[model samples]
Target: MKGLRIIVTVKQVPDTADVKIDPKTNSLMREGIPSILNPEDKNAVEAALCLKQQHGGTIIAITMGPPQAEEVLGEVLAMGADQGVLLTDRAFAGSDTLITAFTLSRAIMKLGKYDLILCGRQAIDGDTAQVGPQLAGFLELPQVTYAEHISIEKGNAVVRRGLEDSTEWVRVKLPTLVTVTAAVNAPRYPMLYNVEAACDGSRIIIWGAQELKVPETMLGLNASPTGVKKIFEPERKKKGQIITGDPKDMTGILIDKLQELNML
Candidate 1:
C-alpha cells in the first residue's frame, strides 16, 4: 500500500439531534449548537487510517464548508491523516446536495491520483445520502455505499453493506469510492503528541473554482443544477400520555381510546 493515496471527504454539521428551528427565517439556528464530525464520516476516516496502517499509504481529508470547517479537518489530521484541503468560497453557500457533490468531486479530481475515496454514509444535518453516490457518478467510478466492513486483498476489495432488509457483500476493484456507516468501526481519539503535531503541522490547502481549473458552469452557483427554493421547519407533535395498569384493564382502555379516536 506504499503507493496508495486516499482521500476522505468530511463535513461539519450542527448537532441536529438538539437543533431548533428559527421561526423568523424558517431556518435552523446552528450557532449555539456544538459542531461535530458526522458520525458516519468518522467511520470513513477510521477506515482510511486502518488502511494506512496495513498498507502504508497516505490519507488526505477534504472538506467543503465555511472557513471554520478547517477545525474539523484539523481534527482528522490529529487522528493521523497526512493532509487536508479546505474548499471554501462565498459562492459555495446555499448549495444543495447535488452542487455539494460536484464541488467535492472537482476538488478530488484536482488532487490527481488516488486508490480509494471514502466518505460518511450521510451528514447528520442534511441526512441526504446522495452525495457519495453522486460523486461516484461524477467520477465515473464504482462505489459501495453503507459499507459496514471492508477488506482489501491484493488489488481487489470486499465490502459488507447494510441495506434496508438485510446485509449483502460486494466485491469491488481498486481505485473505488466507499461510503462507510458508523457500524464500520469505532474511530480513535487523538493522543497528546499527535494533537501537538497536528496543531503545528496541519495547514489547510484552500482551493477556488479557478484554482481547480473547473468549468465556471461546473462549479459554484453557475454550475449547480439544483437550488433550495425555501427552507422551513416542520410542525412538531406532542407526545401522548402513557397509562400503566393491569394488562387486561390497560388493553381494554387502550382499545376504547383508539376506537374513540378512530385509530383502531
Candidate 2:
C-alpha cells in the first residue's frame, strides 16, 4: 500500500480541574485559565504518529478554537505531526458539537486527500463524545469509535474497540475515521529541536470562516441546536439526626427515618 495520509483532530481546553462556570453567561469561564491540548486528543496524535512511523506517511493535526488555540497546533507539531492546521474565527464561538463537527468536516474537505482521520474519544471539558461520529456523518465516511488498537495492511484498517462489557475488532476500508480512547497508546513528548521548530509560524496554517466559506448561519451559536440556559453550583444541604440510644432503639429509629424518607 502507498504511504498513508493521516489527519488527527484535536482541541485546546481549559484544564478540567481548574475549569469554572460563569454564573452570568452560564458558560465555561475560560478567561484567565491555563489551557492545554485535550488529554485524549494527545492520545489520538500519538496513534497517528505511530501509524505514520510504521507506514511511511504524513500526519496533519487540526483544531478549532480562538486564536490562542494555535498553541495546540504547535504542540502537535512538536510531537511529530508533519503539519498543523487551525480553524479559528469569532463566528465559531459558542458552537455546540454539531456545528463544531460540521465546521471540522469543511476543513477536512479542503485538505483534499487523506487515508484516515483520527480523533480523541471525547474532550475533557464537554465529555460529550459526539463530535467524532458527527464529523464522520458529515463527511459520509465509515467510522470506528472508542478504538484501543489500530493496524493497517493491504489498503484496510483494522481496529480493536473497547466497549462496556466486551471488546470488538473491526476492519474497514481506507479513508475512514476513527475515534480513539486513551487506552490506545501513550503519547510522546516533543523533542527539543521539534519543540523549537514548532514555534515557527511557517509550520502552522490558519484558516478562518472566510477561507472555509462556511455559511454564516452555520458557523456559530446560531447554528447550535442546544443552548445553556443557566449554570450554578447545586446548593449543599445537610440533614442528620443522631439516634443516641441502645442498638435496638437505634435500629428502630433508623427504620423510622428510612420510612420517613420513603425508603421502605
Candidate 3:
C-alpha cells in the first residue's frame, strides 16, 4: 500500500444555489457569494480516505481554481488527505468542462504515478457531468462513473455503477478512474488536531500552463470547443393554486383540473 497513490479531484465553486445574477454584466456576481467544496466532491475525498485507511496509501486531493482555492485544499488535508495541488493561472479562467478536464488530466500526468483517480459525479455549478469521463478519455484509461460503492480485491477494483433502472457491477484493474456519487457515504469532518496540522503544513502546489506544459490551444477558453451561448435567469413560475377540499373532493377537483388542462 506504501506504493499505492490515490488522487481525488476536487473544486471550489460559488454557492450558486443562492446567488443572484448581475443584470449589468449578464454574469453572476460572485462577490459576497460563499464558496464551498462541491458537495459531491466531499464524497470523493471520503472514498479516497477510506481506501487509504484499509490499504496503506497516500491520498492526494487536486483542485483547479483561483489561488484562493488553497483554502479548499487545506480543508481536504484536514479531512485526512496527505496533501493537495491547486492548479491556478489566469489562463485557466473561463474554462468550460472540457478544458477543465484536460487541465486536470495534464496536471495529474505531471504528478507521476498513481494507482487510482477519484472524482465526484458532477460539480454543482456546471453539472456537466463530463469531466470525469473526459479525463479518463484523455488519459485513455477505463473509467467507472456514477459509482455507488467500491471495493478492492487483490489489485483489482470492483465498483457498482448507477444505471437508468439498476446498478451494474464492474471490475477493473488498478490505475482506473472512478467518479462517485453522494450515496457513497457521509463525509467526515477533520478533527481539531488534524485541522491544526493541515493549517500549518498545507502548501498547495500551484501549477500554471507553463508549469503543466499543456498546450495553450488545449487549455482554458481557447481550449474549450464549446462555450455558453447565453445564461439567463429562469422566469419565476406563477404560484400554484391550492386545491383545498376534502380528500375525495380534492381528488375530483384534481381530475377536473387535469381534464381542463388537457393533461388527463
Candidate 4:
C-alpha cells in the first residue's frame, strides 16, 4: 500500500464564548476577543492524523485568513501534520462562503495531488456548514458531511455520518471531500516543544492571491454574492412548552399544542 496525501483545512475563529455584540451597531465586536482554532476543526485534524498514522501519509494543514491565522497551522503542525500553508491576501478579504470556497479550491489545486480532503462540519463564527460541500462542488468531487467516523478500505473511503435522528453510511472513492464532526475523535494537544518550530516562518508556505492564479476581479467582497445585511440576535417571543407524562399522554399533549398552532 502507498502513503496517501491528505489536506486538512482549519480556521482561526474568535472564541465564541467570549464574543460580544455591539447593541448600537448590532454587529459582532471582534476586537480584543481572543482567537482560537475552531473546535470542530480539531476533530478534523485528528481525523487526518489518525488516517496518516494508519496509512502512512503526509498531512497538509491549510488556512485562509490574516497572518495571525498561522497560529492554527502551528497547532496542527505541532500535532503531526507534515506541512502548513497560509493563504492570506487583501484579495481574499470579506469573502463569503461562496468565494471562500472558490479561493480554497484554487489553493488546493496549487497544493497538488491529494487522496482526501477533510474539514470541520462548520466554523464556530459562521455556522453555514457550506464550505466543504462548496469546495467539493468547485473541485467536482464527491462529498460526505457530518462524518463521525471515516476509514479507507480497498481504495474506497467509508464514512459514517450522523443526522438529527438517524445515521447513515456512505462509501466514496479516493480524492474525496468529507466534513467531520467532533464525535470523530478527540484532538491531541499540540506538543509544547514543537510549537516554536511549528510557528517558524520558514516552515510555513505563505501564498497570496497572486500565487493563486485567480484574478483579483474574481476574488474578495466584490466577487462575493452573499452580503451580510445585519448580524443581530433574534428575540425569543414564544416560550417552549414542556410536556411530561406517559408516552400516550405526551403524544396527546403534543398533538393538542400542534393543533392549537395549526402546525399539525
Candidate 5:
C-alpha cells in the first residue's frame, strides 16, 4: 500500500517560558534564550503519525529557520517521520509569518505530491496562529484550523474543531491542510533505534532559497508591507486588594469600584 504522503511543518522557537520582550522596541528579546522544538508542532507530528498508523503513509517533517533548526527536524524523524527537510538560507532570515508561509509553500511545492499538510495551531513565540492558514492560502488548498481530533474516513479527513465556547465537526477533502492543537494527541518520544538515523546528516535534505526556485523580490521582508514585528505587554505595577465579605457585598463593592473608575 502506497501510504499517504504527509508534509508536517515544524518550527524551532525560543522557549517562551524564558522569552522576554524588549521594552524599547516591544519585540521578543531572543538573545541568549534557548531554542526548543515548538510544543504544538509536536502535536502536529503526532497527528501525522496516528494517521500514518491507521493508513500506511510517509511522514515528511519540514522546518525553516537558521541551520540550527535542523536539530528539531532530527527530533521529528526520531519520533517516526520518514524524512526531514530543512529550509535554510540568508534570504529567509527575519521573515514574518506571511513571508514564512510563502517560503514554505515553495518548499512544499518542490516536494511534489502530498496528501495532507499538518501544522501546529500556532508557534508559542509569535502566538499569532496565522502561518498554517496562510500557507494553505498560498497552496490554494482547503484547510481546517484549531483541529483537536483527526481521523480519515472514506478518503476524507474528519476533524474535530475546538472552539472557544463549543465543539464543531467537519469533513474536509484530501490534499488539505489542518492546524492542530495540543489536544490532538500526546506526542510519542523518539525510539532509541531511530535516534542514530535521525542524527545522521545524510537523513536531512537541506534546501536553500535557490532550491525552492523563489525570487529575491518575493522571499522575505519585501514580501510583506508591515515591517514591524513585535509583541508587547505592558507591566502592571498595581497591587490587588482583598475583600472579605458576603457574596452580595462583594458584588456591590465590585460594581461601586467599576462605577468610580467610569468602567461600568
Candidate 6:
C-alpha cells in the first residue's frame, strides 16, 4: 500500500479554566496567560498518528497563530508528527472563522498533495465548530465531522461519527477531510527524546503571508465579515431564603416553600 499523506490542523488557545477577558478591548487577555494546544486537536493528531502507524504514512501538523503558536507545532512534532507548519502573519490577526478557514485552505493547497486532512471538531476558545466544515467547502473535498473512529480500507475512509444520541457511519473517498471528536482516541504524551528534538526546531516550517502569496486585502481583519460588538461578564445573581426550624419543622417549611413556588 502506498503511504498516505495526512495533514492535521491544530490550534493554541488560552486555557479555558483560567481565561480572562480584556475589559478595554473586549477581547481575550492573552498577554500573560498560559496557552495550550486545543484539547480536541490533540485527538486529531492522535488519529493521524494512528493512521500513519497502520498505513505507513507521513503526518504533518499545521496551525495558524502568532509567533508563540509554534509551541503547539513543536508539541505535535513531539507526539510523532513528521513535520510542522506554522502559518503566521500580521495580516492574519483578528481573523474570524471564515477568514481562518480561507487562510488554512490556501496553506493546505500549497502543500501540493494530500490523502487526508484531520482537524478537531472545534476549538475551545471559539467552539463555533465551523472551521473544519468550512475548510472542506473551500477545498471542495468530502468531509465527515464529529468522527469518533476512522479507518482506511482500499483508499477509502470508513468513519463513525459520534452524535448527541446515536452514531452514524460513512465511507469517504481518499483525500477527504475529517473533523475528529475527542472521543476518537487518547493522545500520547511526547517521549522525552522526541521532546528535545521538537524543541530544537528542525522539523518545523514557518510561512507568512508573503510565502502564501494571498492577496493582502483578503488576509486578515479586512476580509473577516464578522466583528465582536462587545464582551462583558454576565452579571452574577444570588438568591437565598431563611428557614429557621428544627429538622422536622424544616422539612415542613421546605415542602411549604416548594408548594408556594408551584412545586408538588
Each candidate's lDDT (Cα)? Answer: 0.85, 0.92, 0.87, 0.91, 0.91, 0.92
Candidate 5 C-alpha lDDT tens digits along 75-163: 89999999999999988877889999999999999999998999999998888899999999999999999999999887788999999
Q: Which ten residues in a row have the lowest lDDT in candidate 1?
A: 214-223
- When 1 and 3 are scored with TM-score, the better candidate is 3
CA shift at 97, candidate 1, in angstroms?
A: 1.5
Collision count for each candidate, in order: 1, 0, 0, 0, 1, 0
Which lDDT tens digits does candidate 1 get at residues 54-171? 8888999999888889888888988889898998887787667788888888889989989999999998877889999999988989999999999888877789999989999999
TM-score of each: 0.86, 0.87, 0.88, 0.89, 0.89, 0.87
Writing each residue's lDDT as its tens digit, candidate 3 over 1-264 gives 465599999999897776677776666778988898888899999999998888878988999988889888888998989978989998998788888888999999999999999999998877788999999998988999999899877788899988889989999999899999999889998767777777775356778999998777777877778856667778999999999978999999999999999998
The TM-score obtained by model 5 is 0.89
RMSD in Å for candidate 3, one decimal? Answer: 2.4
Candidate 6, residue 175: the lDDT equals: 91
In model 5, which residue pairs have backbone atoms overlapping below 3 Å?
3-56
Candidate 2 vs candidate 5, lDDT winner: 2
User: What CA root-mean-square deviation does each model show from the true structure?
Assistant: 2.9, 4.5, 2.4, 2.8, 2.7, 3.8
The order by descending TM-score is 4, 5, 3, 6, 2, 1
Tell me the lDDT of candidate 2. 0.92
lDDT of 4 by residue, 37-147 (tens): 999999999999999889998999889999899888988889988899999999999888999999999999998899999999999888889999999999999999999
Q: For model 1, which pairs clash? A: 217-223
Candidate 6 residue pairs that clash? none
Model 1: residues with Cα > 4 Å off, grouped in runs: 1-3, 23-26, 201-203, 236-264
* Model 5, position 213: C-alpha lDDT score: 84
lDDT of 2 at 1: 68
